[model samples]
Target: MNFPIIHTNFWDAVIAIPIIMIITQLTKLIYHTPSKFVPTIALFFGLFISIFISHRHDLLAGVLMGWFYGYAAIGNYAALKTAIKSYRNANK
Candidate 1:
């Protein structure tokens, strides 16, 4: 099986994941998305961005990177929330 050469550029690291997270949060806020569905929405946004925008020429690369982008966003959100909650509790 020939794997596509996936190049991780500035867009992937410094842009796509954060954009996906922001869009997911906006979707949650605008449509009142339930917390349970937020990750899935993030995944969809990741896939859309990766497949259509970032990794447009390679389907395999797009799917793989899309999963990474989605999961990374999800993890980042969870970690940030936990840190903030801990900080608040510590302050209080």
Candidate 2:
């Protein structure tokens, strides 16, 4: 079995942290949800779209993926807000 080699280089860490922070910010802005969930949901959406693009290898598919990713993220944010409101009301 071939295992992927992981590197722990300083340069890699420097580049990776900013990229992660940017993604977290973007997800929070686009989704308009809490910052806490942004990273998790953004990574999930990014991974799904990335995999789809890699397998399909189509430009149009990539564009569609971007659109769907945004739509899904926004929808998720709305759903989250609604659920929280419902829970609060129920508890009160």
Candidate 3:
């Protein structure tokens, strides 16, 4: 299987992941998404952005990068939340 030549541009570096995170959070806040399904919702948003907007020219690349974007955002959110909680506990 030949891999698509995916180019990582400014959008991928600075935009896509945060956009996915923001959209996912907004969806949670607006629709009251359950915590258990939040990651899946992020994944859907990531796939939609990657497939329809960012990597439209390459289907394989889009799907692959979409997963990364989704998981990366999820991880980032988790890490940030943990850090804040730790800080609050320490302060208390």
Candidate 4:
């Protein structure tokens, strides 16, 4: 089986991941998604984007990069949450 050629680029981290993160977070807000399911939802969002939007022609690449997009969003969310928590604690 031939694996699709995949390359990581600035767009993946800078643009795609953040967009996916925002979409996932907003979705989570609307749905009241459980914390355990958050990453799973993010991954699906990434996979959807890769398949339909960004890397439609390259299935493998899309899946791989989509994984990045999902995790990246998760990480971003976690970091932001941590910072906010720390700020609140400090303020109190």
Best by lDDT: 1
Cα TM-score of candidate 3: 0.94
Ranking by lDDT: 1, 3, 4, 2
TM per candidate comes to 0.94, 0.42, 0.94, 0.83
Please report the TM-score between candidate 4 and the true structure: 0.83
lDDT of each: 0.90, 0.52, 0.89, 0.84
lDDT of 4 by residue, 1-92 (tens): 97777766787578888888888889889999888998899889988887777788888888888887888888889999999999999999
RMSD of model 1, in Å? Answer: 0.9
lDDT of candidate model 3 versus the reference: 0.89
Supply the global lDDT for candidate 2. 0.52
Candidate 3: lDDT of 69? 89
Q: What is candidate 1's CA lDDT for residue 89?
A: 100
Q: Model 1 clash pairs? A: none
In candidate 4, stretches whose alpha carbon ends up further than 4 angstroms from where it belongs are 1-4
- Model 3, residue 36: distance off in Å is 0.5
lDDT of 2 by residue, 1-92 (tens): 64423323455334433444456567678779776666466555544553354324654544444444544555555687799999999999
Better of 1 and 2 by TM-score: 1
- Write down the TM-score for model 1: 0.94
lDDT of 2 at 69: 51
lDDT of 3 by residue, 1-92 (tens): 77789876865847988888899999999999899999999889888888888889988889988888899899999999999999999998
